[model samples]
Target: MGEFAKRHQSPWPIIVCFALNFSKVVALLSPIDFLFYLFAGFTLAAGVGVITARNPVYSVFFLIAAFLNAAALFLLAGAEFLAFILIIVYLGAVAVLFLFVVMMLDINLATVRAGFVRYLPIAAVVGGIFAAQLIIMLLIWQQSETPPTLNALGNSPMNQPNNVYALGRVLYTDYFVAFQTAGIILLIAMIGAIVLTLRPRAGIKTQVISQQVSRKSSQSVRLVDLKLGQTHPTTAATAPTEPQEGSA
Candidate 1:
């Protein structure tokens, strides 16, 4: 019975076949295409790890890895601006924020894992729909005709030695208002976040700008007339009380 079960259920042969097929498929891709697939695969795997990791810190690390892999993929696609933005913005700031939040929150891992497992089916369905949409989009993009190498402003990308310079010229020249508007929106969001999270504690003292600015010398200072030898009333030593009888 053991032999029969092992022969029927052992997956080694199937795994070997799949591996061979995958190797054959990989061998057909050019070097650049291989690197693209490599980075893309890492990005996908890291994204999965971010969500599936039990430890929140681990999830953040995985998220950082995903960002790095995605940045590499962007670089391979000649999107240097986007790649640097991913690295500088997401990896530098957002990932650090996620890590700090995870560390400081002191989350209950058991409860989090339980909740994740409970909602896993729903999450899986949503993830499947998103994956399907992404696949369809990718297929359509692959089939679509490539546009001319010229940019929106009638400038050839090849003429610009630096992608950043080209992107900046177009952004500042044509889309300056929109860019400033985005900055304004981001500023508002930052202010809103600060307002939402800021709480006043009963015993904590905070600097009041209005009160400080409005204060006059008279409000903060007291004029006192005194003899040359006399100190301020609050600073002068009190006369020692006569020792209470038998108190010592």
Candidate 2:
């Protein structure tokens, strides 16, 4: 059994050697290999911590660290603009907002788990679909062979770099309209989400913005004071005139 398992899983040394070979190619092309390694290592550690941390605060902190490291890696990958945007937009804004929301929320673990049994079937179906799709993809990819390299094209990948640079240029120039359209679609989605969250309830009353602005305070407030205490002259025992009439 041990021998079969060993055959199934490659030795640690082989895996290490394969990793070194892969990193060597990247390091050869990469100008700042040390920076990339540090960033990549930090990202990996942070990612693990984010998922495994018991405390939500620690998880959020780990996630932020991961995002920062990922941004650094993105910058190293030659997407400096995108890297900065990720830091500014996602890390700075989204992470902090989520962190605050997480801190503010008091989760009822028991109540939340009440539906787990009911939803298990649906969850299983979704999981099965995902697994099936993934297996199919792996089978297809395994069966497909690599395309033959054209010797006429440069042997070095640097000579004909991946579509990153060309894609960026086209995105900013020729496909700018399409990019804006995509942005608009995202904007619409955001608005739709906001609308969905703004559900009207029978017991809850909400004032219209236009009506609220036009509302007068005079109509809402009126001065009406009432006096409850009355003179108790007859009920008092210190009445001299009543005593004289009783004696006569």
Candidate 3:
């Protein structure tokens, strides 16, 4: 039976048939579906490029491209608010910040890349663990009788506002604690970053709020009583004397 199967099999025919079927399916796709596929492809490619690009600046640009494609995907999925947030927060702020930091920092690329091999094992293990968890979750979701509901306030009726309202409602209600925690964590991270980057420079003048606040008027301004047409003695010594007409 194996010999007969091997002899009878013509892989080219099967390949051609599959190709034809794929082409037919592609032809059948709506414009929206085609655009979605295009965006998905760009997103995936840009995501890969972000990690693999040698230059940090290029990596940041790739990351920004990925963010843009992701926002496009979100828009396609009808999550307009998420799309805007991704564009505004990630593309506008985070990606630009990353680019600026990468450009501004004195990073030795060779030194940074030298440790890649050393860290590869740890990265592989962590990635494997994450992949396994994702697979398990996906399996569980696929086998589950009911699909998961993201909206805690229950599915909105067709007449109601779309994903934005649903997301806000659920976020402020069901996921409020998690959202607040995330905000607090981000705030702490921002503060930590500022603290780390701040360095006191020697010989640089800086504002002294305490000194300014505690100063007496006498220390800053002296009220001098002088007879008319008499200059202060210190000022008279420092002031340039008018050139004598007879001096050579």
Candidate 4:
């Protein structure tokens, strides 16, 4: 009891020691390196969650989390524009759209999961191919002799006044042709998707301009004289009749 009371009464020493050790570790790593590792770890964990989550909606949320952590990593790397793009475009728009769509869809989990085993061999082959490609790329990158390059604007990032200005300048000037080409490709893809998905369906109403132009008021409209209390005869005849309460 005395030992327990002593340990509980003077916990400040342990707290101070832990703080000192943490400060030393932070000093060795620097705040930037520490934050990079922190965000990177979070991004990695979120990516794993994205692939492992059973629910599509949960997977989308995990993907969003990964995007957010990646944005933080980008911010730490001084690419503020890319960071915000990840946040606003990918997270705010794309990921949220995916989440809502997944939630709204009537998905059959049993049907989806049933395909996993059947496709496992194909998936494994694809995964192995990708893994091999990645390993080869990593080895090639490690053996490359050329030093890292700067932004496309031929200026160091530190010298630029703002990231957006530098990025826009590079994109519009140095890579203008490639940028336009990408835009054209995206436009073509969008057109193809629209064409494929806009196929006509049965029982759908469509406008006919020539028919509308050739139509006359006399063909579509009817003028009838009726008493104030009487309904139109055509409507009266076409109306559905309800069953009498006791007759059925």
lDDT of 1 by residue, 112-133 (tens): 7778778999999998999999
Report RMSD (Å) for each prediction in the order shown.
12.3, 14.9, 10.8, 12.8
Q: Answer with 2 or 4, whichever has the higher TM-score.
A: 4
User: Candidate 4: which pairs clash?
Assistant: none
Better of 1 and 3 by TM-score: 3
lDDT tens per residue, model 2, 1-248: 11222242433553465477966655543346556667878999998998577677788999999999999887666666668888999888999998998789875546756898999999999989999999899779747643324223333222245535544555676568999999999999999999999887788777689976875655343333434775444334455333322221
List residue ranges in candidate 3 displaced over 4 A: 1-23, 106-108, 142-160, 198-202, 207-231, 236-248
- What's the distance in Å from true for residue 82, model 1? 1.4
RMSD of 3: 10.8
RMSD of 4: 12.8
Over the stretch 145-214, how does candidate 4's per-residue lDDT look in tens digits? 4322343435355345587887776677767899999999989998998999998789988899998899
Top-TM-score structure, candidate number: 3
Task: Report lDDT per candidate.
Answer: 0.74, 0.68, 0.73, 0.74
Q: Residue 5: error of model 1 in Å? A: 46
Compute each candidate's TM-score over C-alphas. 0.62, 0.49, 0.68, 0.63
Q: Which stretches of candidate 4 lie over 4 Å from their true place?
A: 1-24, 128-155, 202-248
Worst 10 residues of 1 by lDDT: 239-248
Each model's number of backbone clashes? 0, 0, 0, 0
Please give the lDDT score at residue 1 for candidate 4.
Answer: 11
